[model samples]
Target: MKVLVTGANGLLATNIIAVLLQRDYSVIGLLRNEKSFALEPHENLILHKGDITKVDSYDALLPEIDCIIHAAALTGQDIIDYSVYQEVNATATENLYKSALEHNVKNFIYISTANCFGFGSLDDLGNEEKPIRFPFSNSLYAKSKLEGQEKLLRLAKDNPDTKLVTLNPTFMIGSYDTKPSSGRLVLSAYNKRVLFYPPGGKSFINVIDAAEAVVNSIELGVHCESYILCGENLSYKEFYQKVTKQLNQKSSYVKIPKFLLYGIGYIGNLLRFFKVKTDISLTNVQTLCINNFYSNKKAQEKLKLQQRSIDNGISDAIKWFKLN
Candidate 1:
């Protein structure tokens, strides 16, 4: 099968491309700039320079593409404009879906974040059926992705022939972090004497595991269905301890109180109001103070997704960081 993956330079997309090549599938990676290409050259892997937000950039290539893993997204809490998020996360998705249909692309796998679903406590984990919850609902990034998911689902209902699968992954950490996206979490506490973290917990997964699930979705995923690809649930304190243990470093873990985080977020809001770019808003801070946990039972049953130890993920990330 010939596959096209967007955000080719992103941590997840890079891993996905590696998996596809290992499975003997031909790949076309769509990236905005050729100079930013991170993957090594391969006989079956072809890199294309294009913009995902603009359909014409990749319209001509869609004819021969059998499956498209739309992994490109505008992510970050720093951006203050919802329109920017909508353009990349929502409008781009709609345009790509329409073009895929016109070109008869059979499988379209969208990569969305778990924040689109309501998070639960350790006792009751969030699932695919949950609605958008607080803090995340206020997040422009999550709201935009949710908007794209809804549009794709609605479009899929009328076009039954094309299989549309959405994979919602939680905090992913592993290798190929050229931009060092999620790896920042690990880097933030690396070799530190004291580690300060929010009081909340989250569902974490290895990027390789998440990438495997994305490839598996092409063959095993059901149409118009969504899966939450998650792994072990750990609080901030527990996670930092794991990081310390993996790095073989001694560190004291301190949990930031919710009030303090909120206060910081208020300051961030003021900065944004004054046209400054910052990621410390109340929404992002509130997200850090809650148990944003999720379940992978659906993905396990449907896509045969496997859950790996987050320790391995941390180790890989640390090793990669050390080298790169």
Candidate 2:
């Protein structure tokens, strides 16, 4: 099998590439720039440099590719224009999906986020069947991803051969955390420098575990299926404790009240409006204070997504942090 993976420089993509190579699948990584790829060379792996928003550069290679894993995106809660967000997260996905379909790619694995579900602290987990309720229009990142998901599902209607599989992961944590999604907190806690603890719950999946689910979906996944790839449910406090323990450090963290955080966040927003840079963001207060545990029973059953334990993940992270 020939697999083309985007976002080859990311933490999850590293494991995906390694897994594909180990399985003897020909892997092609679409790198935005060649300098970012520093891993040891592999014979089965090929490199392609191009932009996902433009299909012209990959027009020649698209036809021969068997599978395409779309992992490229600018994912963040920062204030950015809708047009820019759509161009990278939505428009780019549409272009790639269309090109993959036109080129007869067998399976298209789309790396999606569970954040598209909505804003809430409820323990309600998201799955394929649950309807999506986008919380806000200003949710440029979430809205774009949801639209991308819709596009892929709709494509399955006319093109049954081009299967679409989505893996919705919550706070991914583990090795190769170069971009360090919430995992860096492990290091921060160990260093005894985690300034504040957000009052919230977030479901986390190991990066390697997420990679395993991606490959498993390619091997055996349902069409138009959205699998929530999550693991142990922990509050921000518990999550940091894992890190602190791994680092062999005991640090006391005081949980700030939600309302107090919002007040500070509002000040942060005000500061931003006044062209003053502050370490706070009012828009991010609710996002930081909500419960976000997701269930992965579907992925566990279908993809056999065995997540590496949070302890193990934190251990690996500590080692990586020490080395880096």
Candidate 3:
């Protein structure tokens, strides 16, 4: 089968492409740039440079694609442009769904985030069936992703021929992060850049396992269904200790007060009002404070998913970061 993967240059997309190639499937990557990451030459792999939001950009490649792994999105802590988020995450997905219907794509796996389900506790973990809690009122990143996911799910229900499956992956860490987005946390911990720790915890997952579930969904996934791809939940302190151990460093961080962090967000909003360029924004503060502990019971039972300790992910990420 020929598969077209959007955001082929991203961390998760790189891993997903590796798995698909190992399975002997012909892969066409729809990426904004071809030189973002260094990939080995393969007869089955073709990199098609194009923008996903612009239908004319990838319209030609859609005809031969049997399946699509939609992994492209505008994600960041410093992102304040709401229009860019809507265009890339929401409207682009709407256009892609329409094109998928026209091209008769067999399977479409949309990658969503676990944050859409809202913050939850260990006693009651977040699940796919749960309605997104005030998605529009949430951070710009989560709100945009949920909008795209909602449109795809609705389209899936209306069109029975096109198989659609959604997978919400939690905080993922692994190798091949050329841009070093999520892996920066592991680097920060290993290098002792993280002086202060957050009070909340979050679910973690190895990118390899996340990619495996994405591939498994092509065969085992049911139509119009959503699954949470999650792993062990750990506090920021525990997460730092694990990374410190792997790096052979001492772990000691001052526990930052929650109110101080809230104040930081409040001040960040104030800075935005003056159109300032700062990393510590309201969205970033919310991410650090929100406890995103999710359950992957649905993915584990249905996709036969297996999750290793988060340490493995941190170790691999550090090794890759050091080498590259």
User: Which sections of candidate 2 miss by over 4 Å?
Assistant: 118-124, 133-138, 193-195, 271-280
Candidate 3 residues 83-111, lDDT tens each? 77889999998899889999999999999
Clashes per model (N, Cα, C within 3 A): 0, 1, 0
lDDT of candidates 1 onward, in order = 0.93, 0.78, 0.86
Residue 271 displacement in candidate 1 (angstroms): 1.1
What TM-score would each prediction reach against the true structure? Answer: 0.99, 0.91, 0.96
Rank by lDDT, highest first. 1, 3, 2
Ranking by TM-score: 1, 3, 2
Measured by TM-score, the strongest candidate is 1
Residue 315 lDDT, candidate 1, scale 0-100? 95
Per-residue accuracy of model 2 over 86-193 as CA lDDT, tens digit each: 888888898889888888899999998877654333356655566554333335677788888888788777888998888887777766666665655665675565
C-alpha lDDT (0 to 100) for residue 131 of candidate 1: 98
TM-score for candidate 3, please give it.
Answer: 0.96
Cα RMSDs, all models: 0.8, 2.4, 1.6
